[model samples]
Structure formats: structure tokens, C-alpha cells
Target: MTIPKDKMLEMLHFLMLSRRFEEALTDLCRIEGKIPGMMILCTGQEAVGVGMVAALRPEDVIITNHRSHAHLLTKGADPKVLMAEIYGKRTGCNKGKSGTLHLALPEIGAPCTSTVVGAGPPIAVGRAFAQQYRNEPGITVCFVGDGATGEGSFHEALNLASLWRLPVIFVCENNRYAGAQRQEEHTRIENIADRAAGYRMPGVVVDGNDAMSVYTTALDARARAAAGEGPTLIECKTYRWRGHGESDPQLYQPKEEIAAWRALCPVARMRDAVRARGLISAEDLKAMEARVETLVQEAIRFAEESPYPEPHEALEDVYA
Candidate 1:
């Protein structure tokens, strides 16, 4: 499916915004020492986030793993709220309690997120079940890392989703590495989507770095789900630009491989593509960057002024 020029430009703009936000976060972590370290960035995976969000309605649900800033931004989340959350301010989306792992904005269908690997799939299945039972038209799109597929919950969620034909789209960001381990050291399957056959559903593999490809595949999967078709396993061939998470001394991979992945940076490619297509002028990109910078600055101010959680409130949310 060819996206209109305007929509493509919009996605490109959003992708650039997300990249700038991540960069700001990294700078904050390094310069201000606000966060302990840099986040595992989705630098080469912007297309997946952009494309998938394009296929979704405002009311449609989305759940994802720890690497989900792009998802939040694409869903129209305020940059100020996100930075506030990362800063652990009471005015954040989750009252500054969720941090990087658990951010949610129910109004925009971002219910919550999980830092624990593979937890999103089951939750997505549960959300799908609820929507289906309520006769709602919304579908759930879940993002998982390649490492997540090794978890038992991944299989369990897929099985249950297939059994009930839940409106859940399982998007696997197979960056070929899980934390410090390479995919070669993990499962033996040549393709993660191949496993979907066991559930009797469609298995799709797409270039995750290509925004149009991701959007098209996600649109197809979502259409199938809405039509009562079974779940789909979409393995996105992408790469990570940073270490797994903050404080990861990445020794498991080689510098050459990292450099190689850098060549396929999603945001950079999209910007070039849009320019080549004459969809956006360079000045337009500059204007968008200025807008994103303003929002980021406002976010920092908001986080600084916002209150922190009280001493006793932490225990209140904890279940025994």
C-alpha cells in the first residue's frame, strides 16, 4: 500500500521528533546525570513504530516492551509528559512512578508497558480478549524483542491468542540480538515468524527499517484480525543503536557489526527518501526540528517544577 505524500511526510516528521527526544534523553543522562545512563535506542527501528501507528486509529490499543518511546510519540503523547515521567515527577503520565519501564496514557490507548521481556504479549492477548468480548472494533498491537521469543510466555500468549482468535498483532523487532547475546546463540529457528505456523496463523517477515513496508504489513495484519482471522507473527528485521539498557557494557558484539547497522539508520533513510520524493523541503524539516526542541525544553522545565512522590506512596501501590 502506497501511503499518500502528506501522510508519509507526517510519519517522517514524527520519526525525526522521536529521534531528537531520544537524543535529548541521552544528553540529559550524560550531562545532568538525571538518568543513570543512556537508553537502548530504537534508532534503526523508527519505521516499525511509524508504520504501525499509521495503521492504527486513535482508539486502537498498543502495548510494547521497554523500547517504546517511538510508540508513545507516534501515538501523539506529549513530549513534556514523557520527559516528566522519565524524570520521575508526580505530574508525569503515571505520577512519576512508572519510570522508563511502565508508562501509560489510557486516553490515547497506551495502557501501560513492561520492562520484563515477553510480558507484553500475554497482556496484549488479554486486552484483545476484553475488546473482542465487549464487541469493540479496536485491535491490540504488541511489540517484542527477539530475545522475548525465547520466553515461555511468548508461546503461551500466541497459543491462547490463536485459540480465541484475539485481535492481537505480535510484532517482533528482531534486531538479531537480545541484550548482549546474538540470535545465533539463542533459538535455532531461521525465522521467528516461522514459529507462527504452529498456531495456524499468517507469518510475515518484513524489512523493519522500511516505514512503508512495516505500515503495509501491519495494516494487512490488523485487517485480518478485524475480520476474525487469527493472529499474525511479524518479524521486523531491524537493529539497535545502543546497548541493551542503561549501564550495559556491551562486550558481546563487535564494533564492526554496530557500525554496519548504523548505515541503515531508519530516520536518516526516511529523511533522505522524503527529500528525494520532494514530499518535504529541507526547511520543513528544520521547522519540525525547532518545534521538537521547544517541546523537549518545556518537558525539562515541567519535570523540574513537578513534585516527586511522597515517601509512603511507593508502598501504597505495591501488592503483598
Candidate 2:
């Protein structure tokens, strides 16, 4: 599918935004010592977030994993509130209860961000089933990691989605490593999408680092699900520059491999691709980056200035 030039540029913007937001957040956690709780950033996996989110309709549901700031941001969450949530302030989306782990925006149909390995798939299946029952127009997109494939919930979710022909798009962000263990060491299969065959669902593997490729694949999957087709497993082979969390040591990762992936930076690649297409000039790219930088800084300042929730309001929005 030919994407509009403006939309392509917008995707590039979100890609830049996701990267810069995490960079700022990382600085806040490591250097400034302001952020609370364990922070996980999707620095190298911006393409999967921006591309897929761009492909979906606004009404569609999304369930994200632990590293989900990119997903929420690209899905149109307010940066100030999201950053404030990380800061555990009252102005946050979840009123600062979720922190960096389980960020959810139910008003936008992103009702869940499960940190449990492979938990997103099951929740996505349930949402898809509800959509199927009500004959909704959109599909559920579940973002999981390569590590999530090891969990039994992932298989069960796939099986149910297939059996009932639910409108769910299972996207596995295979970032080469599950925590510290390599994909080969933890799982026997070379590609995570191959597991879709067991449940009779279509599995499409694409370059997770390419925004256009991911968008195209996701667009097709969404179309299929909307047409009453079964779920599709889209394995996005990406790589994360940082460790699992803020406290992880990089002793297990090889310096050479990390350097090689860094060379194929998704944001840089998307910028170059758009530039080659004459969609954006270097000057415009710089201007866009400046705007994003300003936005991120403003978000951080807003979060820092925001107040934490009152002690008496702990159970205000809590559900059983």
C-alpha cells in the first residue's frame, strides 16, 4: 500500500519522539535521579511501535508489554501525562499508579499494558472476541516480546484466537535477546512467527527495524482480521540497545553485535528513506527533531512539576 507522504513524515516524527523521550527518561533515571521504579525503554524498536500504530484505526484496541512507552506515545497518549505517570504524579494517565510498567489509556481503547511475559496475547484475544461478538470494525493488536513466546499464555491465546476466528493481531517484537539469554539459547526456532503454524494462523515475519515494512505487514493483517479472517502472528525482528531494565548489566551482550545493530538505527533509516523519496529535506528533518526535542523536554518539566497523588485517593479508580 502506498502511504501518504504526510503520514510517512508523521511516522518519522513519532519514531524520533519515541527515541528522544526514552533518551531523556534514561538521563532522568541515571543522571538526575528523579524517576521512580524500574524503567524499560524501547529505544531500538521504534519502528514496530510507530508503524503498527499508524496502520490501525483509532477505535482498535492495543495491549502492550513491559517496554510500552513507544506504543502508548505512538497511539496518541499525552506526553505530559505519560511522563508524569513515570514520575508517579497525580496528573498521570493512571494517576501515577502504573509507573513505567503498566501504562494504559482505556479512553483510547488501550486498556491494558501487562508486564507479565506473554500476558498481552490472552487479553488481546478476549478483547478481539468481544469485538467479534459485537461485530466491531477494528482489530486488537497485542505487542509481545520474543521472551513472551516462552510463556504458556502466548500459546493458549493463539489457540483461542484461532479457534474462534477472533480479530486479533499478535505482534511479537523479537529483539534477539530474552532478558539476557539469546533467542537461540532460549528457544529452538529461528523465527518466532513459525509458531503460528501450530494454531493454523497466518504468520508474517518482517524487518522490525523498517517502518515501511512493518506498516505494510500490519496493514495487511488488519485488513484480514476486519474481513473475519483468523488472527495473524507478525514477528518483528528488532533489537533493543539498552538492557532489560534500568538496573540490567550488559555483560551477556556482545559489543560487536550491538555496534552492528546500532549502525542500522531505525529512526536514521526512516529519515533517510523519507529524504530519498523527497518527502522531507534535511532542513525539515532537523526542524522536526528540534520540535520533538522541545516537546520531550517540556513533557519532562511538566512531569517534574506535577504533584503526586494524595494518600487518601489510593482506591479512587481501583477495581476489584
Candidate 3:
């Protein structure tokens, strides 16, 4: 798949933006301690989010996990509003209620996010089922971790999706760890995508650090789903650069493993790939970095300047 130079640059920009945004969030958490909820950084997993979302249409839906900042940004959610939501400000995407873990922006087709490990798949299944029923063309993409594969809901959702030929893409961003426990500790299977065979669906595994690879894989899955071919399980083999949450000590992972994955930084890989093809210049890459820095700073300012939600407003969006 030959991607245009302009599009490749755009993908690189999104990946860089996601990384910078998370870096800014980390700094904010360290300095001001203003972030209202747990901070889960997607520093190294930017490629999967940017590549997968880039393959989808504007109307396509995506359901995400706790580590969802990249997913939201890639789906075209406003960075300022998302930052405000993380800061628990009134002008946030969820009116300061959802926080970092649960970001919901219906206007952009990302209706909700879940902090629960395996909860997102079932919701994606429900949304895809609705699309099938209404004869809607849009498909649902569910982002899950390796841990999710162990849950009953994951199996149940896949069974239903396959049975009904629902237009859903089951994306397992297998980042090696489910919190502190490594994937090998809990599951016997070598690859999460292997489980997809049980549901009678096509299963594929790709180098998650490679953005173009991920994009092509997602594009293929999207085409199949749009053609009424049902759900596909795509397992992206990647690694997380940070601990599970802001407060985690991260004793489980060895320093060497972390260093090795960092060496394969997705952003750096994409930049090198583009530069090697003479698609982008070093000056252009530096300029893009500067722009991303400015954008992140602006989002931080917006979040800080926004007001907190009023006490009475908490009950406003609730339902029985």
C-alpha cells in the first residue's frame, strides 16, 4: 500500500501530537497535581491509535480503554476540551465528570470509553449490532488490551459479533502488560489473535510499532466490515513506556525490556521511514515538533483557565 507523502506526514503529526500531549499531562500531574483522576499514559502506543483511526471514516465509531487519550485525539476530539476534561474543568468534553479514564464525545463518533479492562468489547458489539439493525454503514472499532482476552465478556462479544456478522473491528492492543502482570503470566496462548479463530473470524497480528503496517491492516479490516464480512480480530504487538498508572512503582517490568521497546519508538520509526523515502526533510520534522509543542502548551493553558463544574451540575446529566 503506497500512502501519499502528505498523508504520511499527517500520520506522523498525529503520532507526535499524541506523544507530546501525554508528556504534557505527565508534567501537569507532577507539578500542579491538578489532574482529577488516574493518569494512564500512551507514550509508546501512539502508532496503533493514529494508524487505526486514520484508516476509518469520519462516521466510524471507536470505543476505547482507560489509556484512551491517543484514541480520542486520533478520532478528531478537540485537544483543549480533552485536556479540560482531564483537569475536571466545566468546559470539558464530558462537562468535567468523565475525567481521564472515561472520555465520551458523541459528536465525533467516539461515544464512550471504559476503564474496566474487558468492558469495551461488549459495548462495541452493542453499537455494531445497532448499526447492523439500522442498516447504517458505519462500523464500530473496539480497543482492548491483552488482559481483555482473558475475560468472559471478550469471548461472549466475539461470539455474538461473529454470529450476527456485525460490523465491528476487535482491536487488541496487546502491550505486553495488563497492569503489573505480563501477558504470559495469565494466558497460555502465544498470540491474542489466535483466539479469533474460535469465533470463525479472520485474525491478524502486526508490528504495532510500525504505523504504516497498522494502517494497512486496519484499512483491510474496515473494508471487509463495510462489505458485510463481519468482525475481524487484529492484535497489535506493542509495548507501553510507562507504568500502568501515575502512581505505579513498576517493579514488574525489567529496565532492559523497557529500554529495548523505547529504542523501537514508533514516532522515531515513522520519522525515519518518511525521511529515508525523501518524503520529509529533517527541517520539516523539527518544525512539526515545534508545532506540537506549541499546541500542547495551548491545551494546558486552556485546561488551567477553565472553571470547575458546579456542585449542582453533577446531577444534571445523570439518569435512573
Candidate 4:
């Protein structure tokens, strides 16, 4: 499907934004020793996040996995505050309580970020049920990695969601590996989307590296859910350039394979499409890049300058 020129440009803008955001965050963790914890960067998965969120309404609920810093940006998270949150500053979205892996922009309808292996689908279905029961307006989007489907909870969640015909969308970022374990080793199925047949839902496999392709596929899924046709499982076949997390050396993954995926880089693909279409001038693209760089630098500066939460406020937002 051909997206409007304006929307295409917008998608390109966000792809750039997400890429720069993660690249900057990586620098903070690696070169600067600023962020603590196992920070996972979705360096090559930018298209999936941007495309999914582009198809979704702002009111739509988003549940994501650990590789979520860039996903948060697609939902309109303020880069400055998000950077501050990663820094565990007082001005964070969660007020320095939930760091990199568990940031939530509830007001933007992205309520939770789950790092557990297969925990997101259940919550997504629950949120979908709540919206349906309340006659609410939006759908729930459950974002999971390819490894998540190996868990029993993932299957159970899909079964229940299909049975109830809940308005939920299950997006699997099948990045060829489940945390360094190649797809060939664990799951025998050729395509993860084929598994949806067992759950009695429509499963789709899309080019995760193609921003427009993903946007169109997710757009169709969004329409189906809105029509009360039950959940749709979308498997995004992409690859991550980095290891599963910061600490992993990723020796299991073949360097040649990583290089191949990098050549098909989603960010570069989107930029090239923009240039080919002449939607934006070459100078415009450069200016956009400069703007994104400035935005990320400002975010880092803001986070560095902000103070951490006071010692007494540890339990401020905690239920326990």
C-alpha cells in the first residue's frame, strides 16, 4: 500500500529518531558508563516499532518486551524525560522507579513494558478485554520477540484472545533468534505465523525491515481488530545488529549473518525510499539528521543535569 507522502516522510522521521535515540543510549551505556543494568538496544528493529505505532491510534494500548527504548519514542515519549528516566532521574516518566526495561507512558496509552520471556501477551489480552467490556475506543497491541512464542503462556494467551474475539494484535519481532539461539535450533516451523492457525486467528509474516510494508500490514491488522474480528498475529521477520543485551558477547550468531542484515538496514532502506520518491530534498534529509542528533544530545544533557530521586521517595509509586 502506498502511504501518503506526508505520512511516509513522518515514518522516515520517526525511524531516524528511534535509531539516533538508541545509538545515543548505547554510547551512554558503553562509552560513558552512565546507565546501569542490562540495557537492550533495538538498533535494527526500528521499522517494526515505527510501522506498528504508525498504524495505531494514540489511544491504543501498547505492551512491549525488553528491547523497548525506541518503542517508547514511537508512542510520543519525550526524549528528554525518557533519557532522564534511563538515568534514574527525578524527572523520569516513572520518576526514576522503572528504568530502561520497564518504562511506561500510560497517559499515551503504553501502559507497561514486560521483560519476562512470554509475559506480555496475557496482559495485552487482559487490556483488550477491559477495553471491550468498558466499550472503550482502542485496541491492545502485544509486542513480543520470536522467543516469546516458545513459551506456554504465549500460546494460552492467543487461545483465549481468539476464543473471546478480543481486539488485540500480537506482533512477533522474529529477529531470527530467541536471545542468540537461532530460529532453526528451537522452533521447527518455517514461519511463526503458521502457528496462528492453531489458535484460529489470521497470522501474517511481513518484511520487518521494510517500514512501508510493515505499516501496511499492521494497518490491516488494526482494522481487523477494530472491526471486532479477533486478534491477529503479525510476525516481523527482521534481525538485530547487536547482541540480545549489553552483556552478551553474541558469539553464537554468525558475523556474516549480522553483516547481511546490516546491509538490509531498515533505517537506510527508509531513507533511500524517501530520497527516491523525492518527498524531501537531500538537504532536507541532512537537516533532519542534524535535528535528530541535536535532540538526542539535548536528551543526554538533560538527563545528566537532572537529579536522581530523593532517597525517601523510593516507595512513592510502588504498590508494595
Query: How many residue pairs clash in each candidate at the backbone level?
Result: 0, 0, 0, 0
Q: Model 2, poorest ten-residue lDDT window? A: 30-39
Greater lDDT among 2 and 4 belongs to 2
Question: How do the residues 194-254 of candidate 1 rate in per-residue lDDT, one tens digit apiece?
Answer: 9899888788999998887898888899999888886899999988877786467667768
Ranking by lDDT: 3, 2, 4, 1
RMSD of each: 1.8, 1.1, 1.0, 1.1
Candidate 3's C-alpha runs over 4 A off are none
The lDDT per prediction is 0.84, 0.91, 0.92, 0.90
The parts of candidate 1 lying over 4 Å away from their true place are: 36-38, 315-320
lDDT of 2 by residue, 1-320 (tens): 68899889989999999999999988889855588889898989899999999899998999998889888888998888899999999999999788889898998878999998988999999999999999989789999999999999999999999999999999999899899899999999998999999999999999999999999999999999999988999999899899998789878889898899999999999998999899988888889999999989999999988988999889787688
Pairs that clash in candidate 1: none
Q: What is the lDDT of residue 131 in candidate 1?
A: 86
* Cα displacement (Å) at residue 216, model 3: 0.3
